[model samples]
Target chain A: MKTARRNKLKMNAFAWMLLFPSLIFLILFTFYPVAGALKTSFYMADLSTPQPIYIGLDNYKGMMEDDVFWKVFTNNIWFAVGTVPTSILLALLMAVFANKIVRAKGLVRTAFFYPTLIPMIAIGNIWLFIYTPGYGMLSRFLANFGVGDINWLGTQSLVMIAMIIMVVWKEAGYFMLFYLAGLQNISQEMYESAEVDGVPKWKVFWRITFPLLMPTTLFVSIIALTNSFKLVDHLWIMTKGGPDNASNLLLYYVYEMAFKFWDQGMASALTTVMIALLLLIAAIQFFGLDRKIHYR
Target chain B: MTKKISYTLMYAMAIIWLIPLVWTFWTAFRPKKLALSPSITFDFTLANFSHVWQGAPFSTYYLNTLLVVVGIFTVQFLTATMAAFAFARIDFWGKQLVFVLFLAQIMIPADILIFPNYTTLRDLSLLDTKLGIMMPYLASAFGVFLLRQMFKTLPYELDEAARMEGCSLWQILWKIYVPLSRPAYISFGVVSVSYHWNNFLWPLIVTNSVENRLLTVGLAIFAQSFETGAQWSEVTAATIIVIIPLIIAYMLFQRQFMNSFIHSGIK
Candidate 1:
């Protein structure tokens, strides 16, 4: 009995030994910082001062009263609303078209998927040229249609639209790959039967194809939703969340507060909200959406 | 007729979609004066490339990015392998709880931890270093989970056979398990490389100086120079410098890359 107990203890030690390095990192970077962020949110840590004054709930209250905070928050929701559906719809269309083509399918797939492979920063930089005021690619293209020069990224009304268009273009190709995989998994027999019934192509897509792609849509929606919050790399390159914070996102605003403004307290509070939002997403995915995603 | 229409539409969309990339190459090869002109002629020159090369220390940026990506991947590979082995093969107390904690970490986006992580780096005196940029990413929950899933799919008989051959636990892991999971490793490696290579926000916040800047940040600094906004050729050339390696690698291993993405997504 003692021998077996000692052997079990030895195995436990060995397992933990292997996990030591990774556990240290997970604790230090993720868990420790999360706790620290939560703690700091309650204390006003003026970096210039030696001691931080404990200011409980003030940071949260400040956010409640801040117009910019509300704007930034709403802008993020709008951004998600703008990018998520459009990208998914475009991806579904792209996948359907790519799936239909019998010739040069590889070439067509490449054209659609290439953007997803490149970095968002590169895409942002490229589109910065395209959105440049005069003599820009976008301007030149519009000018050919006798349209006047419209500052794409400069005007507040059009800035989010510009950001949305660029993001949709970047993300649709990636989401298309998921749809393509889902489309391929769909049984050919079902399509054959539907065709034998002489169903219209749109009805076939709506009734059979669309319903079958529900799991892919759910998966892609979660990804796209996460990305809408996470992807502020483009803002850094293109607008720097400028034109009166018109293009600012929740995470971007957190960054500006933490790094640029150096307000660690408010930043932590903002981060807490971001975490809350992420938790909401997790809840929606696991509880609300996962049941609907069939596992066949 | 429908087939013909689909072909034409697909081809047109494909061409339209690729125009930005094509436009990038076109503008990169053109001279500064003719880059924005409404002409279809290919007045190509390598002058923009030469100018952009000397304009910034791009070579250093490339080296820094290469080192950061490789460094993060190397550390991640080692840590993930060991942790995954324990989780997959070793039965230990609290293993399920520990694994759940790891999954929870995956849900917490790294961006949200920027402040506290920055403070941690500052406290450690590792600020403005490439290690700072690579540190938070070293313990990737995704990597550990990926490797654990991969390891679990293998039969225990392989480990048993290796043990009978007098192989140690470490040897069985590296020799038996690692060799059989090449596809998983390759897929993970490709995903990790692309992720860290193009990673901007974390690296942007961590590194401040030109010496430690990655290619994305370096390109950002170059493009942010408002005076050079009209210097379309040079900006595009700089952009090309940052993205060309990834584009070439993607083109070469297009199948593997796409398959890896597909696999990761479905998983």
Candidate 2:
């Protein structure tokens, strides 16, 4: 019996040994950097100057007062507001259509999903050409209807709209995959029973399919919200948060502060804020919204 | 009538989703002069394809991308498998807290870590190295969580049977668990490979020279020449070159790719 207990302890030790490398990586790369960023946010670093000055909450105070920061913050909120609901709804619609449709289902699914496979940078580059003036595809296509050329990216009001269009196009298909899975998990018996009860298809969807898909919807929403913030990769390549910072989301603003301006301290503070926001969103989703997801 | 309207709407939406892709393919093959002309009357040709092939070091970028992707995957598979086994099978102190901490890592957008990661790379003297770009991604929290979930669903009898046959833990993992979990591995592998292959921002920041640049970053540089106006044909040609392999892979394994996305979501 003692030997068996010894063997179990040995096995547990070996398991921890197996886990060590990944733990080291997580500590050094993820946790350490996060801690470092938190520390850095309290100091003011100037590249020209030799040392970083310890300024407690000054950066945060400065950010609160900064007009550009407020603009970018509001822009990110608007971006989330614009993107999350639209993309989720579109994804559900597409998934329902794909699920119900019997003909050429694979081909239709592939076509819808193809955009998600394209790299964001490539998408940005393609859309750059599409959004270009007279010589662009959109412009020429519009010309066929005598709408004339409009600079989609150049106008401040339209820049975010253009971004939303690109984002929705890229995201809807990806989210549809989740909804498709949710749809599959809902047994056909439920729908058949509903039909036998003389329930309308729409009502069946509302009462059954929609509730069943609530978990998937919540999961997709969290992912989409995070992605909306994280997807400033395109902004880096295309707009650089321009047309007067109208297209700058939080991540792009952080990128600008860190790399473009070399304000590491301010950048760290911005990153901290972004991280805090993400954590809050994640907490709410997991604790608040996820409880509503019906589990069979 | 309502069904007809909904079907028509679906078709219209699908068509709208497809237009940019169709336009991209058209521009990729269209001759240079015609490709950029912005007129619909232009004739298609293979000139842009040929030009793109001859004008750039696309082969190197492809090789670099493949190397980085395979390298990241190879490391991730091993690390995730081992870590997941520990989390799923082993009883240890602090297991719950450790798992929660690992899950929390998934929420922190990796972009936030770039500055410190850049500094870390600089300290390691690994700047401009493909290995450097792959380093941080080698052990993903997402992978660990995914594989752990998959491992839990596997029957305990398999492990017990292997142990009864005098198999060590590693041997059991190799002979039983790994083989049984092939679907999860494939799904994780597909997602991981595609992500690393299409990764741009980290690769862009780390790789300074042409030697190490992945296809995405290489295409970015090739497409963005600020001195001159954008060249739609050349850019489309480059995008085609970058996307074709993955597109082909997707077509061949369309079902698997869709399954991976589904599994990733539900997990």
Candidate 3:
């Protein structure tokens, strides 16, 4: 009994020793920066000046009334509204089709997923060419059918749609992987049972497969939501929030504030708000959406 | 009838997916003047490829990217493995709390950290260096969580056997745990490499000049320089150059890569 206790103690010590380096790194990089950002949000820190002035919620107050901030926020909502459901639905459809078909499954999956492996910056560059007005692929293709060239990235109304198309194209394959996993996890026995009962394929999907895949859906939604927030990388390359800030998302706005305008305080405040929004969404997923879904 | 409909749908979907890629490939290979032509003609040439190779410092970009990626992965692997082992096998007080703190890092959107990380980098005098870009990504919460889950599935008897053979903790990790966790390592490595390879924003913010610029950032600069109008051929050439390695890697390890994404999802 004493030896067992000693062994356990030794194991615990070893574990701590193993974990120490990672813990230190995490503390320095993740926790420290987060805390610093939170703190700096309340202070006006000028790089040229030595001391930070305590602003006491002024930055947050100013952000509340900032038009560009609100514009970016609304644009993000519009972006999410446009992209999320389409990507999810397309992913689900692709997964179902790929799962049901036996022939050329690997090839089909590769074809779908190949675009995803390409860097977003590269995709942005390619799409920029495709979206260019007269001498680009998209315009030329349209002109062949007696249709005139339409400004894709230039128009306010169509720019978000253009971004959404690129986003969905880049992301559907990734989300489909989750759905594929979910589809595989659903036993063949369930489908067979549904068939034996004379249930149609549609009904089987609606009743059995869909409900069972709710956890996967929730998981994918969280990732997709987070991705929607984080996917401003392409916007930097393609739009630069241009045509009078039509394509600006919240994070891009934050980048502009900090990097372009050099308003560190306002940027930090904006970042805090973004963080809060993310947490709220994460909370909703964890508590609300996830709990309502019955898995297994 | 149903089978035919499904086949048709599948083929249609495949074609839709292939269009952009086919366009890209065509633009890359087409003669410079014919790149944006309305009609498809097979006047393929290597001019664009040679132009891109000669015009840009692509070799330097590739080397820098490799160094940053490998450096980040090496540090992250060591740190994550050690942390995961502790979380899985240790009975330390406050373990759960510390683990929760680490998990919280997963939700912290990396963009929010850019300014502070930049400031930190500036303070360290590490800006524009490969190490500067890699430093922030050296400890990955996702990796820690993943390897912890893998370690938990491992039987404790193996540890016991190693201990009986007078193996120290490091020896046991190297001998028993590390070898057993190959799949986990491969999956994590795939995800990590692809992420860092495609990563743009952090590298963009940190690296000021071409000396340290990664491929993604270099591609962005190349794209940005064509402000007046789209240069379809040159841009497509650059895009292909940047993506072909990753595409080839994916093709070679398609199954393993898919499995890695699946494993990441499950974790």
Candidate 4:
């Protein structure tokens, strides 16, 4: 029994030795920054004020009062609402067709999935050229309908819409893969029986396919939601959070505060807030997943 | 008739999806003078690619990107492997809680913690280096989680048999566990490589100089919105250049990429 205890202790030490590398990194990068950002959020600091003064919650107060903050917050909500559902719907549709289509199956899948592989910077840049006035593809296409002369990225009203459209185009293909996987999990026998039963294709999809894909939908929703928050790369190219802070999402707003403005205090505050929101989203995902295991 | 109509509709949608890419290619190769004519022309040129290639330090950018992606993966594969082995095989102290913290790290990715991570790298004086971009990302929580799950599935008898044959842990892992988990490794490697390759924001934040500039950042700078006649032509070329390798890779390994995405989601 003593030797067994010694062996167990030795095993623990060996395991820890193996885990040392990851543990060091996770503590420094993930755990330390989380704590550091939370601490820094309370201080008053910026590019000018390198030495931060401890001012409890002043940064948060300032953020709450800041009009741009409110604007960007609402804009992000609008962006998420605008983009996620549309992308998911398009993904479902694309998955249906991609899974079913006979001719050009490879072509269909490639067209839908390739954009997801492209960098957001390139996506934004390509779309930037596409939205260029007069000579741009979008302008030219609109001109064919005699509805030209809209400044896509310049106008506050149109900027979010334009960003949303571009993002949806970039993202729908990615979400389609998830839905496609979910579709495959569903037995082919069910579909065969559905065909024999003469139930309409639409009904078969809604009644049979959609219900079974709840888990994927839930999973994809979190990814889409988090992506809506985390995705600020395109903002750098497309609008830089816009003509007048119109297209700014929360992540870009944090970026603007921290990097562009060099307001360390405000950046920290914003970063902490984002960490909170991300945690909240993750909590929702875990709780939803938990319910599946325990209740149903 | 309905089936034909729907197939035609789906095919049309597919073509519509392909247009942006095709248009980018067309604009990229077309003669500089007629890039914006909207009138179809047979005229084309490789000069746009050449001009942009010369105009920016693209070769350095490519090298930097390749280094960062490969460097991050090499470290991640090793670290993730070690951590996963421990988690899967060992009854370590506080394993459950430690794993929960790792999961929390995943919920908020290293990318989002740019502000604090910048400071962390700054304190180390590693900013603007490829290592800075790769540092915080060195130990991937997602990777550790993925590999641990894969490791858990291997039969225990192989491990015991190897141990009986006087194999050390390294030998067992290298000779047995690693070979058996090739599918998982490929899936994770593909996902990680593509993610870091296309990664813009974190690398964008961390690196500043021409020496450390990545493809996406270099392209972002090169493709700035100056209203010159040759803007779209060159911009499309630069864009295409940035995406071409990934596009080629996707074309060759479409099945693997798609399978990785699927398995990653479901698993």
For all candidates, state DockQ relative to the true structure: 0.62, 0.61, 0.59, 0.64
* Tens digits of lDDT, candidate 3, B1-267: 986897798778977887888888888899988865667688979898888887888889999999988998999999999888888877876787887778677788565578777777888899999999988888888998889888889999999998899997788777888889999999899989989999998899899989999999998887777755647788888889888888888888888889988888778
Residue B52, candidate 3: how far off, in angstroms? 1.4
TM-score of 4: 0.97
Residue-level lDDT tens digits of model 1 in B1-267: 886786687789888888999999999998789887777886879999999999999999999999999999999999999998999899999998898778767678676688889989999999999999988988877878788888999998888888899998888888888888888888889888988888888888889999999999999888888584678888889989998888899889888888787766775
Native contacts conserved, per model: 0.66, 0.59, 0.63, 0.73
Query: What CA root-mean-square deviation does each model show from the true structure?
Result: 2.0, 1.9, 2.3, 1.9
With a 3 Å backbone cut-off (N, CA, C), the pairs that clash in candidate 3 are none
TM-score for predicted model 1 compared with the true structure? 0.96
Segments in model 3 whose C-alpha atoms lie over 4 Å from true places = A1-12, A46-51, A291-296, B1-3
Best candidate, DockQ = 4
TM-score of each: 0.96, 0.96, 0.95, 0.97
Off by over 4 Å in 1: A1-3, A47-50, A292-296, B1-7
Clashing pairs in 4: none
Model 2, B15-121: lDDT tens digits are 88888888888888777667666557757687887777778788899999999999999998998899999988888777877887777678885666787677678
Worst 10 residues of 3 chain B by lDDT: B223-232
Superposed Cα deviation of residue B214, candidate 2 (Å) = 1.0
Clashes of 3: 0
How does residue A75 of candidate 4 score in lDDT? 92
Question: Which docking band does candidate 2 fall into?
Answer: medium
For residues A1-296, could you state the per-residue lDDT of candidate 2 as single tens digits?
99999988898798888788888878777888788888989999858645999999999999999999999999999899989999999999999999989987987898789888899999998888878887877888899999978988888999999999889989999999999998988998988888999999889889999988988899899989998778877887788899899898887788778778889889889988988998999889777888854211
Better of 1 and 4 by DockQ: 4
